[model samples]
Target chain A: MPDKFRGNLLALAVMVCLYERPMHPYEIVLTLRQRHKEESVRLNYGSLYAVIASLLKRGLVAVVGVERQGRLPERTVYCLTDSGKEEVHQWMADLISTPTREYPSLAVALTFLPVLSPDEALRLLKERALSLETRLVQGQASLQWVQRHGLPRLLWIEAEFLLRLTEAELQYVRELIGEIEAGTLEGTDFWKALHESQELSLGIILSEKAQYPEETGIRAGGQGTAPRKRTRHG
Target chain B: MPDKFRGNLLALAVMVCLYERPMHPYEIVLTLRQRHKEESVRLNYGSLYAVIASLLKRGLVAVVGVERQGRLPERTVYCLTDSGKEEVHQWMADLISTPTREYPSLAVALTFLPVLSPDEALRLLKERALSLETRLVQGQASLQWVQRHGLPRLLWIEAEFLLRLTEAELQYVRELIGEIEAGTLEGTDFWKALHESQELSLGIILSEKAQYPEETGIRAGGQGTAPRKRTRHG
Candidate 1:
């Protein structure tokens, strides 16, 4: 019932692992790695014990017993309590159900990309396409491995989501690159002027249609007409 | 240059605005809001001044002059420095070009969903589908508004990306719901036994194939034959 556990993915993963049965922190780590849950859960081995301890204090998990294996150190095994089980379901439900606001850094960057010059933008975007190409190849290989090993769809659905997003970025960037190379990108004139810090008439407006509030419509000492209409594919 | 400004999206936006011409912070805020950059740049009005101060100290921006409008307080206008112009291009380039590690919370939750019972998962997933449906509707309206207003594609590309992603999530969630309702989810049997805490045999392996290292596999005191092969659509 405590709000502290909310959004703590590691704690959630820990509880989920224990739900299968009682597990020592070491086993939890190994299970997560072997299952390839590593992509989703970024865990610190040292902090995992701390996460389990906090769960114990919160009564979400109970220390069922200590186990010793073949000359190894004694490990405290933990089990998910009934409350823990309920919490996992509710937490996962909230997480998967809700569309939260996330500030993906690349998304933010792309939104403000007009700040850069066309050539510079093209150069960097080319770099991006190359990076994405490499990543796509790697992603394809890993996805195939998941399929080859016959893992459940539930296990690697996130990988598919990531792959889709990466593919989208690549496609968009490549198209933008093509537009830039062809000198057909929307607002190219305005962007080029700004990129070169060139002077223009007081009416030269870069934003299409002058749709922004008049007060915020930066005159920039330019008398400019509206930029050309552009579509997403344009 | 320094990596300090690599993730500073707000500063980047501010400088981008200033690159158009000298502007007061109020104008910067208005421009960002008017341009709908608020979705990507999370800014605190009070902290805008602090960000500007930091940028000034870092020589990315320099104050030009003060302007008084209609008895209002004289606002100090700032312009992007030459280095600032260079920085914006480099920063934008680096951001657009690099694929950073993003910890999307939804992706993390789905990876560990084995914690929830099939029924609970279905219930939560239904809730998710409903939320996504509402979001998809809103996103469609917003996209239409952007198109109707004749905003350039560069301005709303991020929104387009977001809408696409939301659509994907909705589509995937709906498919998952269908599978769950039909009682045909790949790991349903394995998940159900764990959900009910029922004893399963080793022959009842949850995954379609037993590919995990033996040492890390959770025996759970039951033998599981392999679960069925399930595709993303399955």
Candidate 2:
């Protein structure tokens, strides 16, 4: 409920593995890799031990046993304490059931895209379309590989999600390129005019800076006074 | 081209705005908000200035003019340097055209799911399904709002992407729940067995630690064993 343990994927992973069975640190590493979980959860042995030590400090796990197998180093196994079990369960519940904000870079780029010249924007978008198409093909092949290996669909749902997302993005980008080519994009005129006017305005400002050097003291750009005029809010 | 300036959304937004024309810091803030670009890019005035100062330092943007408007603080206008224009265009090109690795938290969550009990996992998946459905409805309403406001589909493609993703996730979770209920999931049996055996093994480990404290000196687990077992590669 405190949500303090959020986003610590390594801790989540260690707890998850310990919940399955008490494991020595070495066994935990071996098991995670054997199951291909290393792809999702980082599997640094040093970090794994640190997490275990923290878990012990928190009383989330306790030393269960030690094994001396044919001169191998003493392997101290760990198992989840009652609190550890509860922690992992609640953490997973929070992660799965909640829809938190994710800031995708592509989303951000698209939001500010009107800055580019339409022709340039179109050419770039076509490039994007081609890239997305290539990715879709790669994703499809990867999905096929997963399927061929006979991994559970549930286990590889992430791949499926990604493939579907790539497909959707490819379709959307293609449609957008078509709209730009047909001159049907809603903001095209505004975007183009914004670029043209800004270029001219820059010329004026550059000359002004040259004429009055004292007025243009560079303190910082973002610290500006609020406009006295009420600007429309989104 | 080295993809150095990729994913800095604030810098991208600032550069994009300056690309249109020279703008004082306050004007940039106002225009970003007015255009609803704030929804995607963070609009913190302090960070905006920091980005601007960095841009100036890097010679990406230059001071064009200074304005003293009606008792307001002296406002320094900024315009993209020739290099700034090229940087923004190339950054956008990389962002749109390259499919960079995005590590979504949900993908990570799915990877370690075997730790949860089947019933508990099913319950959580159902909860997620419900949340996704709620989000889908809200996303639909937001899309309708954007459509009614007459914003271009191109501008609001992110909303569309989000909606589509939500729908896809809902469908996947529901299907996953069905697989769990029907006992048709590929790894459910293995997961259940792992949990049962691990719980039993922990009982033994706890008792062993009690009986033989000497063997388990436990100077924090994992400071044990050979320095050289070649760990398999991921």
Instruction: Give the top-scoring candidate (DockQ).
Output: 1
Summarize candidate 2's per-residue lDDT along A1-234 as a digit string, tens digits. 357645457787777778667788887777655444554555587787787887788888999988887796788989888898888778877787775555667777777566556777788878878877766665566556656656555566655665666676677778878877887877566556656764534222112122121222221112233323335321
Point out the worst 10-residue segment of candidate 2 chain B by lDDT. Answer: B204-213
User: How big is the positional error of residue B12 in model 2, measured in Å on the Cα after superposition?
Assistant: 1.4
Per lDDT, the best of the predicted structures is 1
Q: What lDDT tens digits, residue by residue, belong to model 1 across residues A1-234?
A: 765567467898888777677778887776665565666567677778878888899899998988786787888888889899788777877787676766677767777766666787788889988888877777777677656667666556676766766677778778778977887766676667865875522122225246743332321111223332322210
lDDT of 1 by residue, B66-167 (tens): 888789788898988989978877787778877665667877877766656678778888887787777667666666665676665666666666666666
Each prediction's total of clashing residue pairs, residues at least 3 apart in sequence or on different chains, is 19, 4
Candidate 1 residue runs with Cα over 4 Å from true position: A2-5, A21-30, A44-81, A181-185, A196-209, A213-234, B18-30, B44-82, B181-185, B196-210, B213-234
lDDT of 2 by residue, B20-91 (tens): 688888778876655445545657887888889888988989999888868868889899889998898788
TM-score of only chain B in every candidate structure: 0.74, 0.72
